[model samples]
Target chain A: MDGVLKIFKFELHNLSRSKWVILYAVFYFIITYGLFQFESSQSRVVVSLMNTTLLFIPLVSVVFGTMYLYHSREFIELLLSQPIQRTTIFWGLYMGITIPLSLGFVLGVGIPSVAYGMNKLEDVKVLGGLLTMGVFLTSIFVAFAFLLSIRHDDKMKGLGFSILVWFFFGVLYDALILTGSFVFADYPLEKAMLFLNFLNPIDIARTFLLLQLDISALMGYTGAVFSKFFGGWMGMTTALGVLVMWTLVPLLVALRIFRSKDF
Target chain B: MKSVINILLFSCFVLPLHAGEITVHPGDNLAAAITLAHAGDTILIRKGVYSGVGIVINKPLSLVGTGWPIIDGEGKGEIFTVMSDRVSFEGLEIAHAGLSYIKENAAIKVRDVRYCTIRNNRFRDNFFAIYVSNSHHSVIEDNLIFATVKRNTSTSGNGIHVWKSDSIRIVRNDITGHRDGIYFEFVREALISDNRSEDNLRYGLHFMFSDHCRYVRNTFRGNSSGVAVMYSKYVEMTENVFENNWGPASYGIMLKDINDSHIRGNRFANNTIGIFAEGCSRSMIERNDFADNGWALKIMANCDDNKIFKNNFIGNSFDVSTNSTFSYNTFENNYWSNYTGYDLDRDGIGDVPYRPVRLFSWITEHQPASLFLLRSFFVTVLDLAEAMIPVLTPAKLMDARPSMRRIL
Candidate 1:
């Protein structure tokens, strides 16, 4: 336990010294406020927040996290040589990345949302969406960075692979799904689409937030079908469950990989 | 004792059972008077300017305005707080809200209200023109909202805003000179149609991660750019006209990170770029017209597997420009005015494949200064050579089945 705690503190201290987290937080805050102000309609705040979170947060998380792992390779090696177990080092790094990013999100995006959301009770839905998305993305990318780190000794290649992973999950995966739907138009793949949607962290966040916004109608048939099975509190709960899993699965996989690696 | 009992029974029968109605003239206190009204009451305001603090309604009532009553915020703070259910405020002009970068202030706001109607009102010079949050089954229609011009550093407001609300029908609203015409965040099952949005500094309409929305029959013209659909799925857009939106890196319509949507029967005409789609997939683009643009459709290589079919592409200098091969996307039965293919088989489809983009188009995108040589013979020769040999451009970038007749 002491070993794990030591690793955790060491990792967090290293993260705090980096400039990227502060830059990301400040930029996010400014951009969030700017975008919110750009919207003359108050209702757009939630949608804008969702957009910012889905697009920028994950990208930021993946890039910074992947780079962090690769840059700290020497440190990771040193930690592995110490009295601590590899699992502790991995978990420590994971927690280290997640905490600052999540904190940055809270101070950056979360604070503005709260200030704006006070009179609007529905603003809480947006707040909820942001927090969930921020945490989910932090966990996901931190684990992903670790996975990539273990695969290659080179930092650039590992970072490159992490980016490719983002592209696959963020962009290509949806395109493939779309092609499938087009090719198999008559097939009963609607349910399959729902299942496929869960494969991406962005989709889970989108579904959860959209449901909260009560704008499921925009989702067309997929949202409708999702609502039928998972709408209301139950649907939201299921989405939350999925989000939790999105975090846990990757971390678990990375942990297993880190435990037995020869490095 | 017998007389008193009879009188009590008579009083109960005689008293007005229907909800009361309050009338506010120019100098009257609208907020204080509203508190006096009962449920299902009507607050009828006659004309003239009434400036003060904001008003919050917490009852089921009809708040009617005649002669366009004005509620001036006087730069005090946030205005118009509505916390009730089934409340309606109509036919008023609201303006001059104080700036709060920390708070989302509005001229007329409906928060946590169900079945509310905000119609026939004009919101001018407010941070947020009309703010609706956590409300459902509401109608916000036929309002004229003009927002203040935003500075580059200023955190200005939107014309009509809906956040975390559901089942809203936002129709026939004229929102101009603001940042965003209509902005929806975390809103669901809403119909945003038949609205005219123009001359905004930013997008005409913007929605993020909001699902199951249908945006139809809306005209987005002469804005910085037109509408932006980002990070949401299951959207259906039909019969929307996106025109005259000319600027650097601007388009009639832009889709970023969008998935599984239908964009049909829309017209993107006379913009710098008609449609700029990036990281969007599985969306159907059918029966649309792209005419007279610098570029008709700019599909970035990052996206894949979208279907562009049965559309008319006319008079655009460049029909499409992309870096990668158009591998995942299928473009068929589209009439391209620039196409010069022969149909010897007497079939409606052309016998030879027709390339939608010219090689010079890519050169222009990378080097804007080269646009001066657009009509030069050398450029024409290169385009013709590239078209015949297919050396520079991707072979998959051609429309295999080019329709002879326009299908609109």
Candidate 2:
């Protein structure tokens, strides 16, 4: 446990200083600040911010997660040579990487939103929903990246899988869901479409944010169903619970593989 | 000849006092006061709470309240039943008319009257405040009317309900919490202006079979479904503000079978749908502001030959959505904030034709379940792909000259 804390802090500092995290934060800051500046309407700005969050957060999280692990291979092995348990090393490295990445995302988006006087009750609710969505999507994608990198021995294969996974969840899964819903358009598909969205973390996150921003547009049959579910307490807890499960299940499998790997 | 001139002068200019002013206090019977007052007489009601039921005015008289007198109906029956021409009711606080399943109990019910005026009164807790039927040249203005909403709309009544009337003017009234602010049926040549109607159970203003009616500079906010202009022709709605009316079946203006209408210079903001035009034809929707609405215009398949131009569509979720792939309406010279085309020729109009209807909006129209993918990147990409290839949406519906800037 002590070895884990030591490695965690050292890796956190190392990754933070690599300038990638700072660069990520500064990039989000500029975009968010610019959006808020140019778009006087609050909801319009939220839509732009949500688009950036949905597209960039997952892409950056997956790539950075895999790239960070591969780059710090020597450091991880040097720690493995010590009198420390493998579980400790895995947890330490996982926490160290996820914490800095999510921190970068939060700090990057939070400051701009708050600075623009987003203090109204409705604005705050929307902002909180979007920020939590970003964090969850980040963790989920990072978890997928860790699992993919852990299984692949070759760097090329690992990087390739990371990109493929990001692309599938970020862009492809929604197309599949749309096609599936269209194919079964004859059947009662409101609940079925809801179920399919639950399978894709990106859809789940987008739905959560979209419900808050585009609610006026969504006052239709499907919008009512989504708002009815997501606006309620039980649905809120369930969506978050599903997101947590998405983060944990992959990381748990990756942990098991790391514990007995021949590296 | 001199004697004839004197007679004419006496008859036309000077006569015995035909109109006398009669004052009534709290304990005085209102029906008796009306009985004593003659035609063209003034009945001045002093400031007091009077409990009266079914008080009938069968002769032409002016009922003026001096100090905002309260006329409590005690929740009994129709309060003031005016059956005479040239009768006026003014500056009175009318409250607590009875509720009935069979009868529409109202504070002031004017039937078969002409040149009637109901103005500067406050109405509260009444089934219907002012119910006018078969009346002409009547004016209802400067009245503050409110009622608590019941469980269902049938139990409540409108603020000012008019039926089978013509040449009516409803002006400068604030009405809320009723079934409808102003309900007009079979009415013609009516003018509704400078009113604030909000928080009604159904519509702020419901017009059915009413032709040649105009509403201008009115604010309809928070109504369940802001307003419905149905089965009407040649109606004009100008400079009205419709806001914050968001619901599944809600819209700023629900145009159903309305033809040859002019909806110009109105501002529709923050509504579920700005204007839902179904089975409507030959209307001109121009110079309006559509901002922050869900579907700025949901023109149905049956709508034809309408002109929509010079409107500024800003911040709307979908600028235009239709149910079918064919459109007969002309959308030209509208300023769409979502227009991304360049004006290569340096004219205010864009070089590219701006398509207001998108593929995703069309998809959601047929399959409403796809709205769950709102703002998804994949859905956006699909919309982009469809935009490049002219497919899925109505190919005929495009603004050939989209203004590069907002139409001020």
Candidate 3:
């Protein structure tokens, strides 16, 4: 545990020193602040910010996580020769990337929303939900990136697969759902659609944030079963559980792969 | 000076001598008192509950209550039926009129009465609050009508119902929890203004075959199906607010088979469909604000020669949707918040024509379950692709001159 903490601290320090992390954080802050300034309606701002988060957070987390894992290969080999356990090194590295990315997101969007007087109880809940979704997305994508990096020996293949996974989840998954519903238009597809929504992390995040916003247009479109489920606390907890699974499953798989890999 | 003093003495003393005053107490029979009273007499009812059913006042007299006198109909029949001209009924609380499939019972019924006024009354738990049939030049104002029982449309009656009534003025009334808040059938030259009608089973206000009528500054909200103006001509609806009439088959105002009308300066918000028109022709729908509705305007194929211009369409899911192929209606200079086209020359009109219909709307019209894909990124992509190559949507349904900024 002590060794994990030491490596985690060192990795966090290294990430803070990188110019790309600072630049990414600054970009997110400016874009979020610009959106709030441009639109006074908080629901519109939440929707626009949610779209940006869903698209970019996963992209940045995957690419940055893959590159960091690849560049740390020498450092991992050096630490393997030392007195650190494999599990410790793995968890340390995972926390190292996830924490900073989460913090960057919170500071980028959270600060601006708060400064703009999102102080109402409902507004605070919406902002908190958005920030939480962003953190979970970052962790889940970074864990997937780490798994891809450890499974592939070639750095180019690792980065390519990371981008592919992001594209599939971020964009193609919705297209496939759309097509499936269209083809099965005659069937009672509500239960199937709800289950399919659970399969994609981006969709889960979108549903969670959208439920908080409670825009009537979107709510009117959601099926009665889905609305009944996601409109209450049980549904919220279930969604959060799924997001946690998305974060932990890839992470545990990466840890297992790292345990037996030849350096 | 001497003639003026004599005229004042004659007006005060002689008027009272000719028009006698009859004071009816709680235990007295109101029908007997009304019968014994002469024409132009005043029957003042004291503050007490009077259980009377089918009280017919066939003479021209004034029925005034000092306090709000309670007239309970005991669920039996119509409480007060006025069959004479120049009658005035005011300051009464009428309740529990009988419900019948045959007889159109009401708390107060004015039948073929001319120059009558029904004002300042409270109607409770009545099948029909005020029913006027074949009555002309009557005024119904300052009344509160509330129905306690919730019934289906077929079993319920309207709050204020007028049939074959001409030149009637309905003002300053509040009605709720009825089938239709205010209904007019073949009522011509009617002025309905400054009334609030809400939360009814069907339309807040319904007009059928009513011509030359004008309704202004009224508010209709939270009703099941909102207002309907059908088979009417030369009807002017101005400055009314229609809001929160939300359901699958609800609308702020549905105009069907209406002609030569003007719907101007109204606000429609949070309705299922803001302004729905079918077979409506030669109407001018201008300077209205439609906000946060499912569809701002659902103009059907049968509507023709209507001009929709200078309206603000804000935050609606679909600004304008139609099932028509050919377009005779003109949509120009309306500010649509969803328009992404640019006004490069800065003329405040978009350089490209704005098509208000979307492929998704067409899809939803066919398969309503596809509405679940609303606001999805893929749906947006489909919309953009379809906009670039218009195949499914009607080609002629485009706003030729779309305003760049909100008109109001």
Question: Whole-model Cα lDDT per candidate?
Answer: 0.77, 0.90, 0.88
Tens-place lDDT digits, model 1, residues B157-238:
7888889999999999998887788998998899999999998878899898888999999999988867787888888999
- CAPRI category for model 2: medium
Model 3, stretches more than 4 Å misplaced? A1-9, A40-43, A77-89, A125-129, A208-215, A218-229, A232-237, B1-15, B148-155
Best by DockQ: 2
Cα lDDT tens digits for candidate 1, A1-263: 66667777877777778877788788878877875676543544555566567666777788888888878878888887877777777777887887888888878876665666533665665576667777787777767777777767777898788888877766566556555655665676657767776777776776566555433121222334655655567766777788788778777877787888787
* Better candidate number, 1 or 2, judged by TM-score: 2
- RMSD in Å for model 2: 2.2
Clashes of each: 28, 0, 0
Model 3: CAPRI class:
acceptable
Q: How far off is each candidate at the interface, as Cα RMSD in Å?
A: 18.7, 1.3, 3.2
lDDT of 3 by residue, B57-83 (tens): 888999898898899999888998999
Q: Candidate 3, B181: how far from true, in Å?
A: 1.7
